[model samples]
Target: MPFKKYLLTGLMVWLPLAITIWVLLWLVGALDAVFGGLLSVINSVAPVAITVWSEKLRNIPGLGVVLVVSVMLVTGALVSNVAGRWWIRQWDRLFTNIPIVKSIYNSVKKVSDTLFSSNGNAFRTALLVQYPRAGSWTIAFQTGVPGGEVQNHLGADFVSVYVPTTPNPTSGFFLMLPRSDVIELQMSVDEALTYVISMGSVAPSLPAATLQKPKP
Candidate 1:
């Protein structure tokens, strides 16, 4: 039991950082491949002229890292303007017209923008909910309220919560539970996630008394 607790605690310590580093490495690899391929295409078109500079610029070891960060910053700046916004719309229109690629690309882009954009609201609050069965609960994020016909069908009090699975939070279920039933945890989303994945082995320093709040 002690060893199990320690192992869970250790995973809580390392998993976030490990996953973050893995994602960062994956992005870097993708960028490197894209830029390298572009350089190869240029080299094929113009054999003598762009050989050395293109090779160096495209894959300058650590420079690629700097370039990736710089490009992200530049892209952030561009999307902040009116003309840039129009250009973005046009680009999106082109993508939307594309056959199968549109669905995949647009869904991913929407999620990324929601999660990463400063103006967008997503994962705004972490909640505790009875999951799978009564008495047994899990941590979930309150994404938003039930909308449209679902709201009409389900009633106004239902809310949408994203309940992520352990070990791999990438896949999860979205449940529309009654808003009154959801227990709002005081802990942040990151802390709640650690608690969930560790399966209570790494208990958060929260007390039952502290969780008691006067009904609003």
Candidate 2:
């Protein structure tokens, strides 16, 4: 029994580290594969000396990630100028003129802009709400209020919230509830996410003001 307990404890300590390393290795392999494919295409029509060098470059570990990052940095720098803006507008126009591609591209672009823009309000606040049934509470995030015809029907007192599932936060339910029913939390969005993803095993500490005892 003692040996079994010890083995279980050791596994608890090492499991998280093992999974983290495995995920990182997978990401590196995927990036390397992209670069390898590009080199393979180039090798088809190039001189023998050039093809040899491309193959050698593909074998270098982490080079693909480095090259991709460098390209992003250079692209960002270029896009910060006036001419770059003009070109980007032209690029968007070209894409937007396409039939099927425009619909997909525009939908994705709108979602990305809302999620990643500096001034966007999505996921900015954490809330405590009763979900699935009354008297049962869960952590949720404010993703913005209802819009368009839904807003017209729901009125001004409703908000949109996302409740993420435990252990895997990617998939979740979206609820539009009355603002009065949701209690705003002092904890940050990141803290709330950690709590939810840990299945309430981890909780954010109370704010300093909440910790102070009231004078009798």
Candidate 3:
């Protein structure tokens, strides 16, 4: 019984840290793959004399990290100026004029906007929504709205949502649900995410106002 108690305590302590490390590892692996692909493209376009040196640099430890940082710095500058954006838009227009590149660039732009844009509406809220069936509710997030004439056709305040799976919240569904059906939680977005990712093991404590309220 004493041994079992110790094991349980140990798990309680290390479980969250273990999960966080796993998530960090997954992000690192994904970024490494993306940056490596970008480097490969750049290398293919480089001249013969520069190609050999670039290959050697690419193989070095932490070289990819340096290249990633350099790219980020350049991007930061680009978005900070009128000329830089003008040049970027010109390049985008050029790509859009091409047959094959147009499709790829457009798709990439759409995905980037969805994932990274603040105003894009993905992962905007943590709410309670009836899912799997009515009378049963689940935690989900607001993704966005149905644009154009779709709202007029549906005749409802509809917003996009993401219903995450247990253990790993990265995988989920993109749904469109009516605004009236969603129960907005008072807890913060980060707190809600923690609760969902922990499979209800961790939750945000009730506010003082709610906790102290007396029953009539």
Order of quality (TM-score): 2, 3, 1
Give each model a TM-score: 0.75, 0.88, 0.79
**In candidate 3, how many Å is residue 109 off?**
1.9
Return whichever of 1 and 3 wins on TM-score: 3
* Maximum-TM-score candidate: 2
In terms of TM-score, which candidate is stronger, 2 or 3?
A: 2
Clashing pairs in 2: none
* Candidate lDDT values, in order: 0.84, 0.92, 0.82
- Give one clash count per candidate, in the order shown: 0, 0, 0
lDDT tens digits, residue span 1-216, model 3: 999999999998998799789987776666667767877887889888787876776666555556778999999788779988898889889999999989999999987989798666677678899987999888998877877788787766888788998877889877788899998777878888888888998889997889999978
Model 2: residue 76 alpha-carbon error in angstroms: 2.1
lDDT of 2 by residue, 1-216 (tens): 999999999998998899999998888889899999999999998999999999899889988888888998988898899998899889899999999999999999988888888898889899999998999999988888999999999899999999988888889999999999999999999899989877888889989898896867
RMSD of 2: 2.2
Off by over 4 Å in 1: 1-27, 207-216
Off by over 4 Å in 3: 22-59, 212-216
User: Which of the two, 1 or 3, has more lDDT?
Assistant: 1
In candidate 3 the C-alpha lDDT for residue 79 amounts to 74
Candidate 1 displacement at residue 192 in angstroms? 1.4
